[model samples]
Every structure is written in structure tokens, then in C-alpha cells.
Target: MNYSIKVTGLKYTMTIISATELQKNRIKKLVDLLKQCENINQQIENLME
Candidate 1:
């Protein structure tokens, strides 16, 4: 079966598709990691100021 996921971030939004549940879960995990990285970077920038 095919699965679709919508990922939205501060700058943009997009749709992703996967052929299996495992692939979809992996994509979701990666997206979460990216979001965490963005938040950490923003915190660092704020600290610099």
C-alpha cells in the first residue's frame, strides 16, 4: 500500500509519499529530526545576541 505524509515547516510545506509503512515512519522521524535541528539552531542564534 501507499502512504502520504504532509510536512510543514516555518518556511514551506510539502507532501511526501512512501510505498510502505516502514518508509513512511522513517520519513516522519527524519522530518522530526530536522525540526529539532532548526529549533536548536535558532536557540544558538538567540544566545549569540
Candidate 2:
């Protein structure tokens, strides 16, 4: 019974860790997209000038 409880706890911890990692990856992607957008905007401004 104790062994089963330990296994359940470990699985729960792993799920939480993976969820956070997924969120981090999503945030990184968003940041990269923002940077790309900024670069595009700068190029547009230069073209207009």
C-alpha cells in the first residue's frame, strides 16, 4: 500500500513538472514571435523614411 502511494505521488509530481515545462516553452515561443514582430516593424519604419 505504501509503495502504491509513493508511485502515485511521483506521478503527480511529474505531471506538475511537465505542465510547467510546457508553459515555459509556450512563453519562449511567444517572446521569439514578439522579437520578430519588432524587427519587422523597424524595417517598415526604415522603408517609410
Best by TM-score: 1
Q: lDDT per residue, candidate 2, 1-49, as tens digits? A: 0111122123211122344667767756655665566667777879999
TM-score of each: 0.65, 0.60
How much is 6 displaced in model 1, in angstroms? 14
Cα RMSD of all models vs. native, in order, equals 5.3, 17.3
* Per-residue alpha-carbon lDDT of candidate 1 for residues 1-49, written as tens digits (9 for 90 to 100): 2223332344534366444778777877777776777778778879999
Cα lDDT computed for each candidate against the true fold = 0.61, 0.49
Candidate 2 lDDT score relative to the true structure: 0.49
Pull out the clashing pairs in model 2. none
